[model samples]
Structures are given as structure tokens and as C-alpha cells.
Target: MKIRKLIRDNNYNEYLMDPIYSRLLENVNNLNERIFQKNKLVNLQAFMEGFTFYTSLNYRSTPIDVLPRIISSEFFFKISNYLSARSYVLNKFIREVYQESSTPIPDWIIKTTPYFRSEMIGFSPPKNIYIHVYGADIVRLRGIPFILEDNLRIPSGISYSYKAFEYLTRFLPELSEGYNVLKPNDLEYLYDILRYVSGSKDPTIVLLSDGNYNSAYFEHRFLSDKLGIILAEPNDILVKDKEVVVKTVDEGEVHVDVIYRRIEDLDYLTPGLVKAYLRGWVTIANAPGTGIADDKATFVWVPYLAERYGMKLESVVQPLTFCLYEKENLEKVIDQPTRYVIKKREGYGGIGLAIVKDDNLNILKEIFKEYENFIAQEVLDFDTVVSVVNDSFYETYADLRFFTYYDKVASAVLSRVGIVGSRVTNNSSGGMVKPLWIIQ
Candidate 1:
């Protein structure tokens, strides 16, 4: 009864409400209450705590129904394969966008954004990989998965998800027993990817970050340490003799062969650094100028790219995107702006989003008049899941950020759930990050 009461109105709860999983939920809650009373629950606080600057994660709440939420291996494989297929299609489309192909999009949209790199027109990264790392956001609406955004620049949350899985399962080992947990060697895989790009056996690798000002700065540091790569800031980067090098305290200026860069935009790249990358002196993961695929407008073309490349994007539903640059689409959105969620083309982290209740349509109208850097998608009522907030149980909509690599179809998944009234499932927006375990 306790577990059933915790269950939301989603269709999948019947399986969770089964006798076996219901007991698992009770056991997890019992463990949680015991730890809550004895103050042992604070043990898991170390992961999100210990740093004042990185407080974006909503540790105030977490999910207790691990068994119910652990997706089936069959579902996992389908989603993973879907992302792999889509990633390959997008990568191929990007090559056409840059190098050459009969254009799927108008040339005007291409020249408008700063992401279109004239210099990289004929240039290709090592292994011909434009997107070394990729990720996409998926929100299930009425049982159909819809991709919210495409992350080609820096597909974060791999480390965070892995860290949670690496420890939280150990903290509550009972929840992990029945299922075959799929734990891949993330750090080693990353190391191998970097090494492969570097084209060296003993190449020096550096994890480049925007520094402590970044909200995910903790992840940058954590990944660097785990992957056995030096963490360096933008200022720490130097281009000497057309080669990229990083200044480290332990070693005076070490030559960097591979840079696992996390900069948000191409604006973060210095001219010299870009020159070095273009000249093939060093390799950058995801490569520079890959953000074109990250544009929300570009997302509107994902399905088209899939169709053109003879690939299937059926792993999830494609949100109906209103490309605002077109006259009719722009008019429709401006007329009934609240009917859709208006998003900045290059925006990330769930920022710069406007919807019906925000009551900023007038302001949005003026902004749209000057710039066409916005796209509208019909509002989606995502499916809900059981969530615990401040020790209280309730229902919440969920968003999953499943990671994809150039080589690996899907590696890990991180789920975030926003309670009944909340719209955004981003951790920074008071949404809680929940661990997603794969049912073996």
C-alpha cells in the first residue's frame, strides 16, 4: 500500500506495484527513514556538498522508488540504439553542413548563426568525427518519448550519473540486487577516446574547463581526476609554435595532445587556439564549431536529416518545432505565443525559456521583432513519476539525459524529475536528479 500510494498516474506503475517491486520500494524507504533518523543519510551528502560554488543540484529531494524507475533492459536497448542512429545521422548532416553536400537547409539560416564556421568548411577532426561526444534530452509525454534538445557541444552529466550509480547503489545495496546493473568503464572509455583522437600512445591529455564560475565545475574536476587528465582553465591554455599546450603546476608547460574541452561556445576559443586545432596540432573533443547541431533550429531539422540519411529517429518522438524565422510560423507563434514554449536557439541549461504562464509575451514579441533566434514547440505534459521532496513523497514529471558517443550508442542515463507544479526538470531550476538503473 505504501508503494502503491507513492506511485504516480503513469501507465508503467502496474509493473512496479507487483508484489516483488512493491517490497523493494518499502525496503528502500525503510532504509531511508532509518538513515534519516540516525543522521546516516548525511553520508551521501558528500557528493553534492564540500563545495560552496557548485550548488546547482537539488539534493533537498531524491527518489526512493529505485526499483520501479529502473528501466527495462529491452527499453534501454531501444533508446540507446535510437540515439546511436540519430547521432550518426546528425554527424553526417553536420559534415554536409560544413564540408559539402546538397544542403538540406537554406543557405540563409546557415550564414545567420555564428556557429557556421567558414574556416572549418573543408576541415575535419581526427577520425572524421565532428561530434566526439553527444547527448539528448528526452521527456516522455503520454508514454511517447520526445527529444527536448540536442547536446553536441558538451554532453554533460555522464560523470554525475556515474558518480551517483557508483556510490548510491553501494549505499543501498539491496535496491541493486535483482537487476543486472550495466556499469561500463566510463573513465577508461573516455581515456581511450582521448587517446585515439590524440593519435599517440603517451599523449598528454587535458580537461579544459571554463573554471569555477561554471555550475557544473565540480563535474569537470571530478572527471579530470577520475580520467587521469590534467584540468586546465582557458587562461592556462597557450599556443606555442602552432601547437596547443597547457601550463600545469606540477609540470612546467606540458604539450597537450588531446583536449577534452568543455567551453560553452566558440567565443571561448582564442584565435591562436583555433588556428592550432585547424592545423591539426592538437585535437578537441566534439571539435570546434560543432555547436551548429546544438541550435534549437537545427533540432527542428533532426527528423529530416534522419529521413535523408536513411536512418530511423524512432527511439523517441520528435517535438513539433515552429521555426520562427519563417513568416507563417513566426506569425502563428507571436499570435498565440503561450501555446508553445519559445526557446532561444543557442540556449542551454533550461534558461531563456518562455511559456504561457510566464506572462512575458509582450516582451517576447519585441525581442522577436529584432531577432529571429527563437523557435517554438507545442507545450508537452510529460509523464510523471514518484518523487520525494524534503522527505515528502509525491508525483513529478521526469526528464532523462541519455549520453551517446561516436563509437558507443548509449553509455549512461541521468533522470531529473520536476514535481506536480514545476515545468522545468533542470537541477538548477529546483529539479531533483534521480538515478536511473538498468534492469538486467
Candidate 2:
């Protein structure tokens, strides 16, 4: 409350020009000056609108505290390596899981964990390339950075970050001085890579959406526009004679090259579509039948897996520790709920999360039963800084989600931060986003 009071008095404008704000502003300007020397005057407002639109959904994010909890590169590198290793091991696990089970992946922790589909198994992606695009959240423990979660499933925020990166350069032109900010029109790269991987040099890429009703419709539009790809819904695409094709008005037909599907879950894939993917006529990014790998239960073993798959190279980063939210664990944690958090086994956006200290145990029990969730990640404690918001100060937790792409080459990373207080930390989950600076 005190911080909120201070932030409010300062006003958003003043906060924007504060040290951290100014640093971010300077970094963007300098990067643009060096990199985009040919293109003058970046669009900050448009970028902000993109950020606003995506983060306003279910994210409970507030303004980022002026002072970021910075992690050293050595530490950051460790985290990155860990993610890489985990991805490899998880890939192995997914293949095994699918091989063993005819049924859909279950919610059970141990049994299902060994073969996490979402983690990275079953289905052909670029074999030489690992995770093409990865978005992992980090929170500080004491002073060390810890990985929160990984978003390999249709990771969002690339459009937001690209827009924001340009916007910051324009809004704070004075900040540009030394650095070269790489221009990130990732959608084109994404389309190209998907096509390359699909083994079609010039395939017709399609952006699949559940419908306009989906929360991230804006992102679907953004990517489609950027890549010059066709946007189609399930109904718009039809399967005939074992091939997936898009049906156009006037009874026209369009063949697909590769599918950049934006639909969140496998259930959304038309029944015949999965068969089409299996036949390998139509290609999908990250491919289908890989959802279970990223499941929460499998997450607990990522560190161990890294050692096994990565040839004893420790995981680059460490994930927050996890525990089951059974009655026994809940009873011990009831008193210090804030010290721990309870999350559903299958959750996105803090949907069934219970911050015990902030709420109550009875409520926690109900959530546990209803969601069959996991419990107690030692609260990711980090230093808090003040953020000025609407003439008020709010302390918010900020974490970065980096998007990486792997084409014919090695893997790379793209990063963004979710605004605080939002469980999901996704732009669609009500997060306020800012561009991540790759400071030299």
C-alpha cells in the first residue's frame, strides 16, 4: 500500500521516465538506432495497444515494479541450458508414453510423467533442431533466479514484444545511443521455418483458430498478417480422402502446405485432421500428440532428466520445486498458505490456484478436490520495487517469457515479461507486457 501510494503520486508519465523506465527506453532507442538505422520513427502507441490488448484478458498483471530483480547472465545461462536439457529428455518420455498407452495421456503424476507428450515426445518435428520456440517464466529465490514454468504450447507474446520493441524506440527516442535492436518480424520467420520443416519449400501455410471467439484472436490475426498465411477455422478446413484441405466459397478447394495451428488444445483438432497429420501429408509446427510433456507432473523431473539426456550437463536453469496437493500436504501448509501455492494438475492462468496465506484452507481443499491439482512451490521470493499505477503504487511480480525459433539452424530465444498479480502471466491472461532488452 505504501508503495502504491508513492507510485500514484508520481503518475505514469513520471514512472515511465524513472531509472528503470529510462534504461528500457534507452536500450530500445540505442538498439533501433544501430539496427534499424534505415527505418526512422518506430510506432510506440501501436505497440502499446498490442500489449494492452493481449495482457488485458485473464492476466492480473499490474505495472512492473520500477526495479527489476535482475539475474546474472551466468545464472540465466544455467536456466536456459536446463530448459534445453529438459526438452530433450521430455521428448524421449513423450515417445515412450504414446508407445505404451492407447488412451489419451492421463492426469496421474508419476505414471504419466515418464512419457510427457507435451514435454516433447511422439510426432516428428525437426530432429536436428530441439525446441524451436520456448517461453519460460522465472522468479527469484532469495537472490537467485528460478524457472517457474515453460510455455512450449502455442507460446504467445511475440507479437506483443515485437510491437512494444518498436513502440519504445519511438516514444523515447532520446534513449537510443549505442545498441542495435534487431528487427523482429518473427511471423515471417515462423512461417518460413514451418514450411521448411514440413519438407515443402513452398507450402501453403494455414493459421488455424478455434474461431473469432478464442481469446487470442488478435494474435492469430497478427501472425497471419505478418506471414501472409491463410487463416482458417475447423469448419473452414475439411478432410477428404486422407488429405486435409480448406474449403472456400463457391466450392473452391485449397491445398495446405504446413499448418501453424493456434488452437490451444488437441481436442480442437478435427477428428480427421489428426489422422492427416499422422499420414504426414499436412505438417504441423511442434507437431501433434506432444501435449503431455509440458504437463505439471512431468515438470518435477525436468532437472533429473537433463542429467540423463544432456549427458550430465546440469539443467541450465532450475524450476520451482513442486509437491502434490493431497490432503496430507494441504494440512501441513494450511497455516502458511502464502508461503506456498496450490495449482491444478491441468491449469493455465492460475485457474485453480490457491495462495493460502491470501485465502483460506477450506477453499484450498475444495480447489484441490475439484481440480486434482499440485501444491507448494516454495514461494518464489524476490525483492519488491514500487510501480506507479493510476496515481497508486502496486508491487507486482514480473517474469520473462522468451520465444525461440529453430529452423534449419540451431535454436534461439525471444523474450517478454508478464505484468504482476496475474496467475497466467500471459498477455491473454491480463498481463501488461514490455520488450526484453538483450543487453550486451
In order, candidate lDDTs are 0.71, 0.53
Scanning candidate 2 in windows of ten residues, the lowest lDDT window is 59-68
70-130 per-residue lDDT for model 2 (tens digits): 2334444566565555555655655555554433223466453322444323444444332
Q: What total of clashing residue pairs does each candidate reach? A: 0, 39
Residues 367-418, candidate 1: write the lDDT tens digits.
5665578888888876676654544556667788887777575456888666
RMSD of each: 3.5, 7.0
Model 1 spans > 4 angstroms off: 1-3, 6-23, 29-32, 35-44, 47-68, 265-271, 357-363
Off by over 4 Å in 2: 1-44, 47-82, 99-107, 110-132, 141-143, 177-189, 248-251, 265-269, 311-320, 325-331, 367-372, 383-388, 391-395, 406-424
In angstroms, the error of model 1 at 37 is 5.1
Residue 33 in candidate 2 has what lDDT?
Answer: 30
